[model samples]
Target: MTMAEKATDQAQRNTEIVLTAMRELFAEKDITALDRYWAEPYVQHSPQMASGLDTLRAVVPDLEGFSWEPKRIAAQGDLVFTHSIVHGWAPNPVVIVDIFRLDDGRIVEHWDVIQDLISAEATVDGNPMV
Candidate 1:
């Protein structure tokens, strides 16, 4: 495979790792597994909260059940984009878009936009328009 193809493959694998860890974290209502996927200075851009990994670790427990299904992924260079649906206590189905920047085969930064998937107008192309 070409270098770009290899990078894409690696990025896809990394995305899977992060997604699985996130799902496991929510299913167990714990952040232990999530720590392995997020960087120390991780940044989150969500409507509800914006913080680093440490803060997320502290707040995850307060959330009841959390699980997500990643639907699409695309990557180029060091960035990967993912569209998914998150299901949990606060909302039944929340559309979320996550962007991750990877460094040396590990995720170093993250940004996400989440919206409640309630009405038909709230969704577009099977994802939240954010």
Candidate 2:
């Protein structure tokens, strides 16, 4: 494959890794299991989560029923971003955009924005966020 093709393929793989880890972390709530997916000294930029895997491990719920339905994942180099909908953890379904930075196939830094899911009818553009 050409160099450009190789880069695209690698980016796709990175997107897959981020999506899988997110599913396991939020949907499965397997906090400790993240050791396989995250690098040491993971930095968190979300207002809610603090830095490090230890802090993340302490806050994640070890339960089922939660779900993260990702609409899209974009990746370039070591950065990956996913747009998704979350349910069962908040009072209402929420829309989230998560950004992750990876190193050697392990996620090292993270950021996210969470917003209340809006109704399709309420949109002026008449298009769904997803």
Candidate 3:
């Protein structure tokens, strides 16, 4: 394969790994699994809270049955953008747009915007916003 093709393959694999890890972490609430995918200096930005990895670790326990499904993903160079539907108590289905910056195959930074999916008008094509 060409260099560009190889890079694309690597990026796609990395994205899948990240997504899978996130799903497992959410489903099982296993904070220790985070170390396998998240960088030491990871930063996360959320609608309700913006904090570092430690704070997120602490706050995860308060959340009940959090889960997400990625609707789309786009990646360029070191950055990957994912649009997903997040489900939890705060909102039945929250539309979330997350941007992840990866370094050395690990997620080092993340920023996200979450909006509650209330009425059908809030989405497009009669589907939840993602």
Candidate 4:
């Protein structure tokens, strides 16, 4: 395949990997998916979580009512980013952008920005925050 074709293929695969991992871990609440997709020394940049896959494995099960609905996803090179609406982790639903870096098909690093969802009335422009 051409270099451009290869890059596109890799990006698609990486996006799929992150999407599946997120669905299984948060929506389905299947912790074992971490073993399949997460690297041993997983680096987490989100302030709420610590580095390491063990930390994630330890926290997911107790997260009652947790759910994630991905609005969109994109990928470039080794990085995949997703915009999602999440519930049960905070007092209100949250909108989050999560970035994952993958190596050899397994996620090795992560960074995220999360904000509580606000109603359209709450926005100065009155635009819905989806």
Best by TM-score: 4
Give Cα distance to truth, residue 57, candidate 4, Å: 1.0
lDDT tens readout by residue for model 2, 1-130: 9989988988888888888888788777877668879988889999876888888777677434678898888898889998999886577888999899988889999999998888888889877877
Candidate 3, which segments miss by more than 4 Å at Cα?
121-128
Clashing residue pairs in candidate 2 are none
**Backbone clashes in model 3, listed as residue pairs:** none
lDDT tens readout by residue for model 3, 9-120:
8778778767876776777788876788777677666656665678768877788767777899888777788888788836477878889888888888888887787666
Q: Which pairs of residues collide in model 1?
A: none
Q: Of the pair 1 and 4, which is ahead by TM-score?
A: 4
What is the TM-score of candidate 4? 0.95
Candidate 1 colliding pairs, count = 0
Q: For candidate 4, write residues 20-57 as lDDT tens digits.
A: 89889888889999989998789999999999988888
Reference-based TM-score of each model: 0.73, 0.88, 0.82, 0.95
RMSD in angstroms between candidate 3 and the native structure over all alpha carbons: 2.5
Per model, state how many residue pairs clash.
0, 0, 0, 0
Q: Write the per-residue lDDT of candidate 1 for residues 34-125, one digit (tens) a residue.
A: 55666656666665666677667777787766676778878777788888877773546777788887766556777887767666564555
